[model samples]
Target: MSATVKPRYQQLKDMIIERISSGELRPADRVPSENELVELMKVSRMTANRALRELTDEGYVTRMAGRGTYVSDFRAKSHLLEVHNIADEITRRGHQHSCKVLRQSRQRSRGKIAGALHVEQGVDLFHLLLVHYENGMPIQVEDRHVVADFAPDCLSQDFRTITPSAYLTKISPLQEAEQVVRAVQPNAAVRRRLRMADDEPSLVVIRRTWSHGRPVTFARLHHPGNRYELTGHYSPPGTPKSATGNVVELEIYDHE
Candidate 1:
């Protein structure tokens, strides 16, 4: 560690993230208490307290008055590729789907978003964040970045009435999509929006689509693991003349 790495508090906060990434920490697992961390890491009380405080604020740990802090679930394991709407995905499982728009704004791209869209350091980008409900319960939180080049009229649409998922499909047919999945704890802001419990785990899916050889949009969909699942089917070509059995399985990254 560098002498002037982040503050001890931030370093401790990062440690929680590292442990979660390594599976050393897990959802519902009680994290080391501030006193425990101080004794183990040989840090000051203030440093230990800062780490726990930040972790709680970041939604990486849940702190109880009398009980110790517990780890949060930050990974989505079930991955599948299928063309379906967010509403249909939930309703298929006997759950109702509802969405609430928390924010819709126009901003310039930054960091990796700018790089991915191949735009300048600051280019107009449409941003949206929504909370999805299932059977009157929050299930998924969606955060998206739109490529203005493909959907110039997106800003004019009213997301309060129509979902981004539905709107995008209505305007453009699927050309190509890329998706990725990983475990990530919700930030403080997202945690509250999803109404996630202290013990619940969260899954994040990042998707990007392209049309006319140009990037169309990017989305990050977060799901509560306890109530969501993804499924898909596929068949291989030229699979004839099978005496007993000949089957090939496929793996699809649920994205875009």
Candidate 2:
């Protein structure tokens, strides 16, 4: 018995990926055109096109309508344990940040919302749904629940002018927080709002914050997996580590 051979398109894709991994092709470097790949690899035009399309979809490269395809820029990364505002994060990257408040109202907490906020099933809570954009590209969908006791004016604030995180911080300082990160397939609504492809997955960060030992807010943030990553750095107690210590770790999640 013999092992199966990969398709021609896959072989071409692997070759291009190898070049990228080896730094032969750097970010924004123009990739070989379909015709060029076909001539060089002796593969059909269809095969070359398929390989390039897949690379674009996978975020390895970006294709412009008239311009040629180029290697993609580094995906944006966020600090998992940081409580910074998304707008601030975007601006720090030298990109424009904008937000659309999809929904903002007072609602009664129930089921998972109640559990996350640690409130009674019917207790009033301020709910907010917002989509954040960086350089006009939708990057995150934020669904948040705020305990009324913590931020009484949550519903009145204009989210387009001020983000929920900023408002919450102004009302009560964050004392403690916890977060869980997961990768999931986006539903139709999420995909549509994020302007993502049908096959794109999402990286979701579910977080709960406390102020003065009381639950302040619970937020679920969704990011396109191809465009965002989460990272963290920490050290154990009783160890004086250097700035370049082994405690600095990075995790990269790539979606299929």
In model 1, the runs with Cα more than 4 Å from the true position are: 1-80, 235-256
The count of backbone overlaps in candidate 2 is 0
Q: Write the per-residue lDDT of candidate 1 for residues 1-256, one digit (tens) a residue.
A: 3556576676777677788868888798988888889898889888898778766765677889898889865453333356466777777768777778877888888999987766787888889888888888887788898877667887788775688978887888866888887777767776777777776667778888777777778889887755555545432221224533543444556787
Tens digits of lDDT, candidate 2, 11-33: 88889988998999999999999
TM-score (C-alpha, index-matched) for candidate 1: 0.57
Q: Candidate 1, clashing residue pairs? A: 74-183, 74-184, 75-183, 179-255
lDDT (Cα) of model 2: 0.84
Superposition error at 149 for model 1 (Å): 3.5
Model 1 deviation from native, Cα RMSD in Å: 20.4
Report the lDDT of model 1 for residue 87: 79
Candidate 2: residue 74 Cα off by (Å): 32
Candidate 2 residue spans exceeding 4 A from truth: 1-84, 233-256
lDDT of 1: 0.75
